[model samples]
Target: MSRDTAGTAPASASAARTGTARTGTAWRRMRLWGLAHAVDDLYQGLVPAVVPYFVLDRGYGYVAASGLTLAATLGSSVPQPFIGLAVDRFALTRLAPAGVALAGLGLGLSGLVHPYPAVWLLVLLSGLGVAMFHPAAGKAAREAAGDSTAAMSVFAAGGSVGFFLAPVLATPVLVAWGVGATALFLPPALLMAFVLVRAGRRRAALAGAARPRTGTDRWAPFAVLTAVSVVRSVVFSGLSTFVELYWLRHLHASQLVGGTALACFLGGGVAGTLGGGRLADRFGLVRTVQLGTALTVPALLALRLTPGQLPPLLFALLAGAALNVPFAVLVKLGQDYLPTRPGTAAGVTLGLAVSVGGLVAPVFGLIAEHHGPQGVLSVLWAVPLLGVALGCFLVEPGPADQREPARTMDPAGRSR
Candidate 1:
């Protein structure tokens, strides 16, 4: 018995060490993918930040400038479903690096061009590039993340971080060097692209040749989740578009205070995104999402009802956090529901449906114009209420729904 026990102890220790090492490696890969996600999304944020410079420097009117915005939006948000389909069909491992490069190059060259048509086209192409990155990168991030919602949130939060950093980083450069400074941003993209390529090779070498995907796709639940996501998007976009205006006009705050409020709200989104993932790991994906969606209504109502400047700021932070708690959860759940079509699932959840809010922004604009920011805020709670309703239909993916591990092949084509 003693001899048998001694032999088993070392073997158990070896297995434990192996598991720990694998977990550590998985996290490191997730961090790299997260950084790549940040770099890709930084370009998304750059579009809005650079739009003002185009108006100031090139003397473009609001209409022409809006066309530029439209170009980017149409390019990025549209066709993502198609791109995702292509990714799943072809296994496009190269798309991540290629997409980021194209996104950066298009934006970088847009400012250097002279014609309005050329600038619009470049921005459009840049948007297309952004579209290209999400599905492929999302699938890859999933492979890295496995079943951990917390790990996936790292990728999701990276996007929020990139969006947050864009104006901060690009504003000073644009102010100093005009729009031409956009050319300077290209190098980072190029460098990151190279890094991604190398990372892909290494991951492929470690993971080996891919195995056929396993699991059944559940579209009905995915459809419900999409509705929930769209509702979340509209609420988030509405607040993001008009939160500052709400502070300035309704709360009677100064421009600086308004900006600060917006900052607080966005910053809370970052924190909430991270927190939601952790919560999902513990409380479950569907529950976390439902909780977040339900909480958003009260938080937005509180933000609207709060009278004092200081109190509203707190509520804004809460509102932002509450609304975003499902942001990453939805993405992960979409993949869970459609395990066989992760790229397509990601394209719809991350790119296509989320864009609905942006398209719906004009309606919110009309509302603000007619009823003021407070009126817009009043209507926003109803949006998430609908999300809460839809979320009730969201069934968690079962253990059998989990994806099978990929089979690795040696250079000689033998399974390892």
Candidate 2:
């Protein structure tokens, strides 16, 4: 009887110790993930706020400025698919931190350079860093969340918060200190790298503990979902790039009001991200995405028609709520469709979707130039319409057949 008691006591103590260790590790990893996301947010926000000013102030032509922005976006996006592939093939543990460090170095150097050509080159390099970081980090988030929808939503919210904070922090710095002040971002970037490195080591130690279950091939559903993501991306990009200017120019809103509106949109996104994840867990990913997409059309149309602050504000809030929910669910869907290649799913959803939006920006810019900024809002109506159409075709995968095996592996050795 004493022997039995002693064995049980040791086992119980071991389990408790293991649980404590896991909790500590999870906390550290979450912090690291948030930090990395913040770094991406800071740079993404800094570029748009400062880059145009830098070009105009420096006497570069509008064409040149546009080119620079396009180059940076292209650089950021083009490598993502490859990065996603690499994350799946090689495992993301070490590469994730390295990618963040590279992005930091690229962004830090962008400030040091002066010539327009040099700046463009540096932007391209920084884009590479952004491309590499996203897939790996997204994969880590999914793994950390243990494929739980609520957990993934919390993880996704980190990026939205980062996005919301970036403009608030970088805009003032850029306005006061100019683009050169971007150097300040380096320390945080480096700190995040260190944390990620430690996290990577821990992940590596635990790599063989549990093999992920095999997934299935559901190409028809994935194709439809990808189309929906593309449409969502288009709307998000338009709002991200033009919402402030639109309010100021069209509605006679002050710069402060315009900024506030932009903040509200992103803040709403942060709320939607968290809320949507919980909703997805309780209701199912398809239901959550469908409901969100369905609401988006009316919200966007309202934004176009509403003239007053109150109405537009309400529209913005609803639009944000609708627009943002799809992001977390889409990521979840990608993973479910290609369960064995969670990283790839992340790349396709987060990386490629954003890229598609970036590609669509010039078209919207043309519409803005031709039809005026308010007219640009009209273009956004198409996004949700397309999203709704595509979403109807999205079919949830079954448990034993989670992912489409063929599409899961990228033929190229890159990760998204």
Candidate 3:
């Protein structure tokens, strides 16, 4: 299928329905969607970055501060799958804009609202907005990339980049303008929402041209994929939350060293997410996932058991790669397992299923309180083995594995 996305303006629905309009879109649109994702997640990341300011500026206690996190998580992560189901049922493309806009608007309003519950409610609303953005945007990204995991990773990497950059982006503004500076973030979301609404209205031709050839919906395999994703999520959240503290407590490292180690872990994840797609493209998706799980075991165990301090940093990078190599692969695989409902697959992979780890994190915290952070790391070492066990239950993607050519052919029907 050829693409007709030379400019921002898309063809009319009538044109899309007729044979006149092109079926596919430009990769630039994926960039646009990716940018929208960054904007949505920037707010999600912004919450944590600003939470300290909320405490210092507003005199919030530890319990109050932690409650904000719970509110944000509950509002955002829990509703993702249901929101995804809504997107699949109605093909709710336009909701992406509303999500982004509300996310930004929530932050803006939070700055103006002085009361704690009101501010929490506003942030919760923002979380809801964040939840709304992923399913539909992910579904669109899947179509835009066709079946290319590398291309899909380009879309997913936006979130990682956003998360990595959030503190960088938010700190200076918060310092200069105070917590009310959250309002500054609103314009990007509002503008992006306007563009997405416009883009969604004109996607008829894009949808028609890029519709999947097969219409398979295998829930059983998708369930296995979700289970594997949950395990990966737990490991990722565990490392992200505790690795810095563990290094500081056990290795007797400075704050700088701990922060650097966390940075290494995250940087490895960004690299792994990009690399996983290429590995999947070459070897196959299921194989790629299994490889990640199998390799992750030793990496994590080494981080716990390595006698010296220096090797732990190397192990952190390896552990991050092993655990995250499946990030993009799992999203693509979920869609493959349920060819008819990419939106719902994206919802689980991108949303509620991943949050399952956060729920278990307190359990790890309890273990840490009793056995120390090293004990927490030791217990985490056993988690990846379950990923391998669940991975065995995954069936291969036959036709869904290669649904469409990655790039649209040129007007002359030659490869681009």
Candidate 4:
């Protein structure tokens, strides 16, 4: 019996060591994927930052500038589900790298070209590249993360950070070199693509094996979740566009204070994204999502009612955090709902659903015209109710509904 116990102890220790090593490797890969996501998304943020410069440098009219934005939006949002389907079918190993490269190239060249059509097309191509990156990177991140929501949040938060960084990073370059400084942004994308290629090769064996099949798909729940996501996006978009205006016009704050408010809100979103995953991991996904949706109502309401300039900033931060708590969870939940087609799930959740908010921005603009930014904020407090209501129908993916096959890529960048 002693001999038997001694023999089992060494084996158990060896197994423990092996498990620890794998976990470490997974984390390393997850961080790389997260950074790659940031690099890819930076270009998305750059578009809005670049648009104002195009008007300044090229003297484009409001219509033409809006057209350029429209081109990018159409390219990035429309074809995502189709692209996602392709990704699921073929598991395109180089898609993420190729997409990032294309995004950089398109945006970089937009400033160098003189013709409006040429600039528009280049921006369009950049948007397409963004469309390409999300599904593929999302799938890769998921495989690397396994079932760890906390790990997945790192990837999601990277995007928020990227968006936050873009205006900061590009403003100096654009100011120094004019719009042509967009070319400077290209190098980072290329560097990230190269890094991803190397990382993909090294981690091929580690992530290639298929995750055990956990359950079948549940479309109804996924549909409800998607609806909830759309509502969240609308509220987020409205706040992002109008928050500074709210501070400036309604609160009688200075431009610096207004800018600071926007920054604080975005920063809170990053924090909330990271915290959401941890919360979900501890409390269950659906519960965390519901909690977030419920919290948003009071946060936004408080922000709207707050009388002072400084006090509202606190509520703005809370509103941002509350609104974003479900952001990462929604992505993971979408994949879980349609376990057989993670790319499609990602495409809709990350791409199409989120983009819907931008479409609704004009509506909010009209509201602001009638009632001011404060009115817009007042309306936004009600949007989260839809999310909270829909969230009631969102069950945690049960054993019969939670399997996702691992997507594998060979060293040569081919799906195996």
Better of 2 and 4 by TM-score: 2
**Candidate 2 residue-wise lDDT, 1-416, digit = tens:** 69999899999999999767754544444555655776665565555545544643566543454455566578777888888888888765766667667666777677777887788787777767777888888877766555556666656776777667755665566557667876777776677778777756655645655455475656677778888888887787677666765776688786456666666677788888878887887788898898888888888898889878556877777788889887788887878887777777788887777656766666666776677568778878767877787787787667633432321111111111
Which regions of candidate 4 deviate over 4 angstroms?
1-27, 47-70, 108-120, 171-181, 203-214, 245-258, 307-310, 368-375, 400-416
Deviation in Å, model 3, residue 3 alpha carbon: 42
The C-alpha TM-scores of every prediction are 0.80, 0.83, 0.77, 0.80
| Ranking of all candidate structures by their lDDT, best first | 1, 4, 3, 2
- lDDT accuracy of residue 158 in candidate 1: 77
Off by over 4 Å in 2: 1-31, 55-69, 108-114, 308-311, 400-416
Residue 396 lDDT in model 3? Answer: 77
Model 3, 225-263: lDDT tens per residue? 999999998887667656766776788876456655665
lDDT scores in order: 0.79, 0.70, 0.74, 0.79
Name the better of 3 and 4 by lDDT.
Answer: 4
lDDT of 1: 0.79
